[model samples]
Target: MTDTSRQFVLGKRPDGKPDRDTFELEKGDVPEPRHGEVLVRTCYLSVDPYMRGRMRDRDSYADPWDVGDRMGGHVVGEVVESEHDAWSVGEFVFGEGFWSEHSLLDGDDLTPVDPSLQNLSLPAYLGVLGMPGRTAYFGTLDVLEPDPGDTVAISGAAGAVGSTVGQIASLAGARVVGFAGSDEKVDYLEDDLGFDAGINYKTTENYRAALADAAPNGIDAYFDNVGGPISDAVFSQLNVDARVAICGQIALYNDEGVPTGPRKLPQLIAPRARVEGFLVGDYATRFEHANDRLREWVTNGDIEHRESIVEGFENAPDAFLGLFEGDNIGKQVVKVAEPSE
Candidate 1:
């Protein structure tokens, strides 16, 4: 195999909002596999909001990337060379290959994908059948346990995880309400995804009124993705014994310091609402269980997925910065080098 590579590097830490200046594109030598590693030709790279936190200078649950380090995330690709028998040449797999054209992944980092679905497209492995789907599954089923006839509300309802959460709640017999930024996104949620109601938060001045109009009985469960004023609004409306799952907080990721807001601890105390924070990585033990159920849902048409794919590895930084601008309708991915079969 020819030795060639392209990778995205953190150019500088963002002062407030991230721009293209925050990233740098570079060419590099394709890595060779070590004793327990395999060389993977990158197929598709996942560009998630969480990557924003990783770009920061402070410590997060995940390690922060230095100014010149290659940015890391999930990728689905094919093994072209291997030093480990568990992954052989021509096999499709998911690995932490990042924004590079090629990567030497450790044995434990790769998960083999069924080649029978190769023509179905492997990028789906980075979205619905992978991490985001599992985030929705384990977060809702395990933490929320939404009951039949319950009204479930999801903020950031148009993104990958939020969209899946709404559909899963609907599948489990709950009345679903989705909050998104645009009429187009809200419309898709209501018309296609089967959410009972969709609110365009960008256009609405009174979010509480809109939420109340949609869920007359108050919210029984809330899957919060963007935490800020929206979460505070939802917090004040929880029904007794309501369950709230704290997922991603895109609204707070770029903030300069502790965000100030109206105190809402009273609402939780009054209703006995259970608000729990979860990191999807912590649920790895049951990933197979969640993956199987998500695959079954996809096969049965019970779950739907969409992707906002950017064309090149060089475009990863812009694709990532586009998240805060609401440029992606679903999972944002950068397609690097095509995997060799």
Candidate 2:
């Protein structure tokens, strides 16, 4: 192991969309684990849309990162040093880790990774079988609850969470319509993922018109990931007693101040639709169950997934910035290092 470790810290909070200047890379001595902690060498680091929220000085579901604080997120790594009874050197684990070559984590906070799991790579735990998967699971099964024959619409449908939600809803017998940024992604959703129809929002001038053509029965369930105009269009086409799962608002995440759009409440009133925003942490107790099911689906070919990986720990910030630009097809992850044999 190297004596020096590199990490990215918050250089400054952004006024609007963050750039390379927002991250400060620093090299320091590798940290040692105390009792009940393990030192992990990161293999894969997750870059997600929600991390943008942490850049702000204001409070939200997660605590804001102060200037100079290390940036952290879901990481898949292998233990290199251990001071904990449950973790041993060379074992793979997943947990919250900073954007660094190595990090110290409480053994209790880590989940052991089974490298031999069928049809899955280590990065899968950071995407489809990780937090994004759990978010799609609960948000679809509990919040959106699409019924058989229901027409379900998803915004940002080609992304990590939204993609998973579309598949699960299909498994539940719903006809799925997906809205993505490009025709290529739209094709991926329809041709590869079995979405009934796909609308490339970038090319389409009228969202409601495209939606009407795709979901002629009107939308019975909606899994919203990218809010804004797409959401406004989805609201206008809601069927009676529709359900909307308010997941992430990626479209408005980088806005400088409060963002205003068409009012959607009045549309919901006539439909008597139920809309609920949820955090995956709320279903923490059920994660193991969700992971097991997600694994089974992936293994059995019921669910298909993809990863857009940016190699190197140094590119972690760029991987994150790419999320807003729709540079990834599914999950965006940074490959830091390979697990040592």
Candidate 3:
């Protein structure tokens, strides 16, 4: 076993968009596992849009990480050493671990990875079958619950959550329209994911007009991943009894202060629309059931997922910063190390 573990620490608080200097790579000796704990060698580290919100020193659903603190998120790793009877060496598991080559975690918090599923790639545990997939599943299926023939509109349509939302929405027989940042992503949505319409929001000057053209039936359901102007446009098209799933506000994640935009509530009041914000952790107790359904969808080709993988542990920061720059077409993950043999 290797004696050293490399880790990334938060070197500085970001002013607006995070940069390379925001993280510091440091190496330390891998700690011996204590009783009831296990040592894991990380294979895949997840980079999510929500991590941007946690970078700032502010009150939010997740706690803020201070400077010099270890950056942590979803990781899939192999147990290298286990002091707990419940876990064993060579078993792959998933848990919230720091950005490091190795992690020591309590056995109670981790769930074992299925070796059969890992045959495709360990990265899947950090993306599709993991948190982002569940977020997309619950937000679209549970929150909005679009009916067959319902016109459903989504923002951030090429993203991990948005892409999954589009696919699942299509399966539910909704007329899916997605708004993406680039023409390539728009094509991926409309041509590859089977979305009914895909709008390039970055190039489109009139969001309301684009939405009107796409959903002439009016939007019966909305899956919002990017907020601000796109949301404003979507609100104006909500059909009566419209439902909205507020997933992420990535458009406002890097704002220096609260951003001002046109009021959208007025559009909702008359339509009796519903909007709700949710975190994937809120469905913890039911994760097993959710994972089962998602796995079945994936195995049966009902849910198609993608990952823009960064090659090394050292590039984790670059992968994270790339989220704001729209560098990835799907879920982003950093390969920290190869799995234990």
Candidates in order, TM-scores: namely: 0.97, 0.98, 0.97
Residue-wise lDDT of candidate 1 within 1-341, one digit each (tens)? 66778888888999888998988888878877889999888889998899889888879899999999988989988788899979788888996767787878897778888666577767888888889989999888988898899999998899989999999999899999998999999988998899999998889999888888999999999999998878887888899999999998999888879788888788899899999999999998988888888888887889878888899877888888888988887788888767664
On the 0 to 100 scale, the lDDT of residue 62 in model 1 is 90
Better of 1 and 2 by lDDT: 2
Residue 11 CA displacement from its true place in model 2, Å: 0.3
Best by TM-score: 2
Q: Give one digit per residue, the lDDT tens place, for model 2 in 43-146.
A: 99998988899999989999999999999899999899999999889889999999999999999999988767622688888889899999999999999988
Tens-place lDDT per residue, model 3, 167-222, is 88899899999999899999898878889999999899999999999889899999
Q: Report the number of the highest-lDDT candidate.
A: 2
Candidate 3: the clashing residue pairs are: none
Model 1: pairs clashing at backbone N, Cα or C within 3 Å: none
Once fitted onto the true fold, the runs of candidate 3 whose alpha carbons sit more than 4 angstroms away are: none
Distance from true location, Cα of 185 in model 1, Å: 0.6
User: Could you tell me the lDDT of residue 77 within candidate 1?
Assistant: 81
Give the true-structure RMSD of model 3. 1.2
